[model samples]
Target: MAYRCPTCSPDIMQARETIILVPGLLCDDAVWEHQNAVLSRHYDVIVPQLTRQDSITAMAEYILEVAPERFSIAGHSMGARVALEVWRHAPARVARLALLDTGVHSASADELPKRQALLDISAGKGMTALADVWLPPMVAAGRLKIDIALRERLYAMVERMTPEIHRQQIAALLGRPDARPLLAQISCPVLIGVGSLDQWSPPEQHGVMAADIKHAHYDVFDDSGHMAPMEAPEAVTSALLKWMRDDRGLCK
Candidate 1:
């Protein structure tokens, strides 16, 4: 079965299992370039555009509406929250799940004020100012300073994004509902990954999520931060490939 969307043509394809990858806030498919290249060798990979909707629920709904019948879902940061929403909406449709660098709880009181502050900043100063304030924390310490190419790529990607898109994503993040309560309801295998120094969504948050979810496996990538899949693609790919094969009874 395929879930077709009204805005886009039916992009779903037949495969053993579909893997829908969701990117983080203000991010497009560029974030999953590495994963898509590697994972496509093993399974059909789908990276749906999250631009059609402004809310997390709508994003998840769009993904569900356009995705194949049964698939494994994976997401990062804001995308991870969307993945959880998808699982909550249709648990049976997901064969397995990978929640990367994400948390189950909504932003705390302190966080909420900060997110709102960001909204105000973005509205007043624009995407450039927002990028200046966010890029430092979003990346690992010292990496941006040392790796000129990586830094250029990061900034270029940010430059391509519009302030309006950033505002909508921040709104979604600030308004996201707490997902901890839905953990017990998920019945599929889950893989939770975090970076050792990821301050945005720290390992402790993923640990709590792992503890609560049944059959949830958690891993931490040392020497990496919020952008683990990008910062340490090899490690991320190794873990993901292993999980996918092991869950599907395919030995390599």
Candidate 2:
């Protein structure tokens, strides 16, 4: 279903009991294409554009304003920060939460400088340059050596993104707050997934989160990297379908 906002007329589409997808830093809806396709079979899926805002708070607010009356929300990386902020602003509106390859911890004093440097590079050099520097660590070491076509495809995806939008996303990442204290406040069932080889947000982070949230379940994809939804779509879709059905007792 397509929607034209009553106030701004920005294009918005809703799927039944929508599942809003939030992509990571420097990424667009392209990142969640696989997951969105699979999930749409059973639910309404909305991959909101986060490029319109510069901070996590503003992005969350924009999403809230245009989202369905109630929906399930899932976010990856920077998008996860926005998801948490969305829940913080209106926990009762969320029916379920999925945090994929994300964390609730803030960057440490030691790590802040590195994050800032990346943000600076993204602002100055552009997303292509940043992708060249970032892709190796993002994918598993072995896969990078064995899969040239996949690497090239990923690089091209980043290259196609607008530099200005990428900068806004990086700014949001650097400015996002620590969401640890808010985890316990999430009353809905939460699915925490991570890539075993994702150094950026390791599997242990998901483990810690699963333990903290009263109703959270955790899973780690052994053969995946930071982009689990894209890298292991089958595993991700299977886990998500089971989790949703199990939690809601729907379509069992």
Candidate 3:
């Protein structure tokens, strides 16, 4: 639990308190740089490098080792899986959670073939080829036509990781625990966001998660894909800020 400051309002402290941000697989600090810049003005934010670990449990444990005793957490994609595990291991330490373009179910047998195919392509054609197949579907419609720099940046972010990290992360994702049962047990605030065009993690998935969790907030960015934070930065950042300021336990 966060200790209230004598000089600070409970509301202010809750909104502007320490926060931990987790990046998606193969992504680093750059993934969250946009939100961090703005959130840091009021919130004490930390974006930990997540490439060192593979398993979600191990990754969450490492974060617990480095994070403050209690703070809010926001994560995207694979990082969001780690966030769920973090809450599972230490619910009292988490003040709130934000999951973006993510899912709570375990890796399905149906997904394995697709994932293996990606891995095979990565091993054969190269990481650039891997990006070509993956990145196109991650952005909003017409993004490639208008956002050359953003596309290049996303490619660069994925390119930075080695084949080893890719293999490790994929393995970790395939073995992640099913988090559906724990949703109702969450005592802290919850926020789930996804892009309407996000084929990987459709809005329906988030809607289901939100319905199960008490006072959970759900958002859908109509003009975005999987990368809503980058595709619709202003809207995403605005919603996040508002979620922090408004009722943390506002259900429905």
- Give the TM-score of each candidate: 0.88, 0.87, 0.90
Models, CA RMSD each: 6.4, 6.5, 3.6
lDDT tens digits, residue span 77-141, model 1: 99999999998888878878889998888767787778777777777887678777877787789
Question: In model 3, what is the error at residue 131, expressed in angstroms?
Answer: 0.7
What are the per-model numbers of colliding residue pairs? Answer: 0, 1, 0
How do these models rank on TM-score, best leading?
A: 3, 1, 2
Q: Per-residue error at 70 for model 3, in Å?
A: 1.0
Q: How accurate is candidate 1 locally (lDDT)?
A: 0.80
Top candidate by TM-score: 3
lDDT tens digits by residue: candidate 3, 1-252 = 343444456564333477788988778888887888988888889887777777899999999999988678889888888999999998888878989999999988798999899888777877888888878887876787689989888889888877777888898899999999999998677889998899888899999999999888898987899888788787778877877765443221
With a 3 Å backbone cut-off (N, CA, C), the pairs that clash in candidate 1 are none
Q: How far is candidate 2 from the true structure (C-alpha RMSD, Å)?
A: 6.5
| lDDT, each prediction | 0.80, 0.79, 0.83
User: Higher TM-score: candidate 1 or 3?
Assistant: 3
- Name model 3 segments beyond 4 Å from true: 1-16, 246-252
Superposed Cα deviation of residue 17, candidate 3 (Å): 1.8
Model 2, global lDDT = 0.79
